[model samples]
Target: MKKPAKILTTAMIMLFSLVQMPLTQAAMITTGEAIQAQQRNIDRDNLLSMLQKDELRAQLAAYGVDAQAAAERISHMTDAEIAMLNDHLDEMPAGESFLSVIGLIVVVLVVTDLIGATDVFPFIRPVS
Candidate 1:
């Protein structure tokens, strides 16, 4: 009986010590920062979704731009770079010229298009 009690007590003490240890290292995260990061991810995803469009993908293929490389590049870009690229995209209006826009978006965002802003283009609908 004493031997069983000693073994049980030792097990309980070990379990108690384990429980007393920190479960996980807590990291500080502000709500605003989290929301901003999430928004960036969504925006990046939207741009990637745009790339997946058949017309755009073919256009990219025609231009010899590798779609996979472009996506990988987005992951390494800084927040400011992403914001800048997104701002450019927001300026573009989806229209009959969507193919051209897609080409330019891929080219411009990836630093290969080297063209002027699209907002000034006659076809682009003003952000309303």
Candidate 2:
């Protein structure tokens, strides 16, 4: 009983000695910057949700691209890529041409394939 108590006390002491407090950081952000950041997230969400459209999925299927894979690829896209896509989408008139959207998706997928993020395309060889 005494030995067990000694071991328990030693374990408690070691645990307390090894415990550490996490550090937190805070910074001031300008309103424009905050708005821009929020917009970026919204753009990314829009693009991801766009992949859920049945028409888009059929189009991707016609191109031999998997809808799920394309969605996964979009989720990994950078903020700049998302913004560029959003800008292109905004410029296009509604029901005018979905080709532009498909083109952009192909471009992003190809880029991701080349960078080793995905293997959707057969021709593009990922960098070693």
Candidate 3:
């Protein structure tokens, strides 16, 4: 009984010695910044969701732009750029002004293609 008790005590001491507490870090984030981050995430989701629509995909295809590629590029865009885009989208008048939105899509595609970020149009050779 003494031997068994000694062995158990030794084992527990070794186990406790080997155990380590996890290190944690905490940082203060301003309320405005947190709100901005959440809004940015929501805006990005909305844009990505918009890109998922079949009609939008068809329209993009008609302009020689790949919807998947557009989504990929959008994923790489900065938070500020995404916010700007979302703001523009929100400002667009509803109903008959959809052509303007299409125009906007084409322009964005062309610009990205020209900038070498995308290869949607064959005519525009991205800057080397």
Candidate 4:
């Protein structure tokens, strides 16, 4: 009877050890990989949030456009157009600097005329 009880206890111990082995092996995987996977998930969530924001979608819709299409078009725009868009993005809608902006535009037009690239402004004629 004593021998049978000891054998049963030993078998139980072996079974418990076998069950724990895989859990220990699983923990040995690198923590960095886990963190990187979590960050990728978070970035995906943030991208979805930006795409689904109602205000942004409404602004894009006001132009008879879809937000994703507008974003794609802006991404593929020429550098000059991108710069203009950036400037527009930086402006406050209710701010009053129209005259200053108009003056700067006039100066640019004059310079372009002087350089003979444009002929729209007649005050400065390009040299032949």
Candidate 5:
């Protein structure tokens, strides 16, 4: 190739390479948001831990939800969902029925799906 053509080809290749590279940017977050995020993560971990406990898992099985499948499903919950659930856990009164809480969570997930926040189940119709 001629000199000008060679330079143009090189320039085009460089431009395309730059376009193909990913760009990263960081935005400032409020302290409250940061705390909320951390709490959400903690909540998610605690919930997953509870689900994985053998005794609790056996109860979940009795409720007709497979332990592993329930754990996997919980893994897909959004941060807000997790935080809301965590708040519920934190506020649970002593001696309240624990199995009901798990069942209520399943119901809430189904309701969340109906509200279009998630598409985890196929049987429910999501609200528009």
Candidate 6:
């Protein structure tokens, strides 16, 4: 009788251990899942930077947005705002054009000297 009771207790312990194994695995969160969750947080922060620009915030308010709610909605904004920001930058004047204007002035002066408008350059003697 004692030998049979000891065997039965040992079998029950083994079965319990087997049942707990699956539960432990189910409760475990994978490292990849944790990294993905962190990445999502970083993405949300980037979205907020775009949506929280002063000009963009004012534009949203003009469209009847609640300022506080606008901040909350940043995480949900689509790529449309990014597209609009890109378009806005495209519409700005190019800084290099100002330098081009100066070059044009120098070319005009050289052409005028060649045509005898003024004998400003000693190398170019006027027709006299």
The most accurate candidate by TM-score is: 2
Query: Tens-digit lDDT track for model 6 on 58-92?
Result: 65555444445544543443455334333444455
Q: Write the per-residue lDDT of candidate 4 for residues 20-127, one digit (tens) a residue.
A: 775543346588978866755554444335446676566445534455644444344444544453364347354443333333334444555687865544556897
lDDT of candidate 3 over 25-124, digit per residue (tens) = 8889999989989988888888888888887888788877788887887788789778777777778787633455556767877888889987778899
Q: Each model's RMSD to truth, in Å? A: 11.5, 5.1, 5.8, 17.7, 4.3, 24.1
Q: What number of clashing residue pairs does each candidate have, in the order they appear?
A: 1, 0, 0, 0, 0, 0
lDDT of 2 by residue, 1-128 (tens): 99999999999998887785445678899999999999988887888788888888888888888988988877888888888888899999888547778878988888889999899998889998
Q: Residue 61, candidate 5: how far off, in angstroms? A: 1.2
Q: Using TM-score as the measure, what is the rank order of every candidate, best first?
A: 2, 3, 5, 1, 6, 4
Candidate 3 displacement at residue 66 in angstroms: 1.4
The runs of at least 3 residues in candidate 2 whose Cα sits more than 4 Å from the true structure, single-residue gaps closed, are 1-23
Q: Candidate 3: lDDT of 71?
A: 85
Candidate 1: worst-modelled 10 consecutive residues by lDDT? 112-121
Each candidate: what lDDT?
0.67, 0.85, 0.79, 0.53, 0.76, 0.52
lDDT of 3 at 109: 74
In model 2, the Cα lDDT at residue 85 comes to 87
**Candidate 5, clashing residue pairs?**
none
TM-score of 4: 0.30
Task: List TM-scores for all candidates, in order.
Answer: 0.54, 0.74, 0.70, 0.30, 0.64, 0.42
lDDT leader: 2
Stretches of candidate 4 off by over 4 Å are: 1-52, 93-128
